[model samples]
Target: MLTLRSFEQRDWPSVWSILEPAFRAGETYAFPPQISEAEAHEAWVEVPAATFVACAPGGAVLGTYFLKPNQPGLGSHVCNCGYVVAPEAQGKGVAYAMCEHSQREAVGRGFRAMQFNLVVSTNERAVRLWKKLGFTVVGTLPRAFRHARLGFVDAFVMYKELIA
Candidate 1:
């Protein structure tokens, strides 16, 4: 079982443990592979309107995510989000739960749509998962992502309209 809650200062250690590997590997997010703790906090906590942690019944964090407007001012109705699941907890539906929760939360927060501007093409798991959740690759940006191991790689601009 899992519960979602607002991110707290105490949650950083758990969240960092989940994020560090991904950040160091440079396989997923666009952030620099060597990003510092302070930089990570600025991106994960400070920039987003809300950051959430997914925890087990015992309160151990399984994963975390952040939600924010995809753009500024007039474009603010579109929400954007990023997610990371602990390596040990992968394939157990953490990302799925986070995605579902984000949609409902975004709607409640008055977002009309959700957009993922840079879904790495090689992250087949995430691409498939997001598609399963109703997002479509509205556009592809060729060589937009400088994957650490693969050098420049293609990325997708995925979107899902939540409101009519």
Candidate 2:
């Protein structure tokens, strides 16, 4: 069974194992492809309200996620998050579970909705998964993300209203 746990010092290495390739790929997230470990940690771990690890009974981390405000002031009612699953764990539903959990967690934390600001259109797996999870691509920014392999690609602004 998979379980979600608050980030701990021991979780850093495993978290990095998942994040590094994603960051290096520069495909999904906006982080610089060459971002260093400390820099990546500052951006991924230090800034979010909370970080979590998806762990197995043996304590192996399969994925990680972070939750934060989608924007400031008037936009604070919406939450934003990012997920990274271990390469070995891909296609096994780790991201889906994290997205579901994050929505519940966001609502519990008083967020009225959730927004994904820059979901790469080329990332069909994530786009499909988020849609299946009830989020809508309310808007799209053409050629917004420069996917490492795809050059410039469109990105979507996905949103889900959690309250009313």
Candidate 3:
């Protein structure tokens, strides 16, 4: 039984554990492969306006996500989000659930839209899932991400209107 909920400070360790691998992989997020744990922690939990975690029945975090204003002042109506799941939790609907929850959460946070600034093109699964969840590729940056082994790769800027 997995449940989604607002993140707590106590959840940082588990959330960091999930993010660290993804950030270091250089296969998904644009974060530097050698990003330090402290840096990843600050970037994921502190920089974002809100953080959330999906937890197992016993309260162990299985995945995490963060929501933040896409820009400052005039552009703040659009929000951005990033997600990562524990490797063990893959294929368990964690990402789908997180994305669904994010849509509602974004609207509640006063954001009219949600955008993903960089969806790595090499990450086909993620790109496909984002599309399935109503996001559209509004733009593409050629060779935007330097994948760990694939050299330079394209990235998609995915967006969805969360409010009508």
Candidate 4:
């Protein structure tokens, strides 16, 4: 079993382990593959309104995500999030739980909806999963993502309403 909780300073090591490989992959996220630890920490923890970690009952970290408003001022009603699961924990439903949890949490935090600014086209698994979770591909940005292995690829802007 796994549980979610607010990230703590002590959680850094565990969260960092999960974040490194995913960020280095340069597939799903736009961040550079060789991002430094301080930069990663600042973006993942310092910038987001809330950062969460998924942990096993015995305290092993399984995954992490950061939730924040998609924009400022008039656009702040929409929330945005990013997730990264530990490599060994892939295919085990960690991300599914995180998405479900984020939707509920977003509503509770007063967000009217959630949006994913860039879902890389080649990351078909994520696109499918977001659709399964009720998100829609509202727009496609052509050759928007510079995937490390696939060169330039299209990306989708996915969105889901949490209220109304």
TM values, all candidates: 0.98, 0.97, 0.97, 0.98
Q: For model 4, how does the per-residue alpha-carbon lDDT over 10-91 read when each residue is reduced to its tens digit?
A: 9999999998988888888999889999999999999999999999889999999999999999999999999998989888
Instruction: Return the TM-score for candidate 3, rounded to 2 decimals.
Output: 0.97
**What is candidate 4's CA lDDT for residue 94?**
91
Model 4 local distance difference test score = 0.94
Report clash pairs, candidate 4.
none
Candidate 3 per-residue lDDT, tens place, 1-164, comes to 78999999889889888888888888998888889888887888889999999999998899999999999999999999999999999889999999999989999889999999999998998999999999999999999999998999999999999888
Q: What is candidate 3's CA lDDT for residue 134?
A: 95
Q: Name the TM-score of candidate 1.
A: 0.98
RMSD of every prediction: 0.7, 0.8, 0.9, 0.7
Pitting candidate 1 against candidate 3, the one with the higher TM-score is 1
lDDT of each: 0.95, 0.92, 0.92, 0.94
With a 3 Å backbone cut-off (N, CA, C), the pairs that clash in candidate 1 are none
- The TM-score that candidate 2 achieves is 0.97
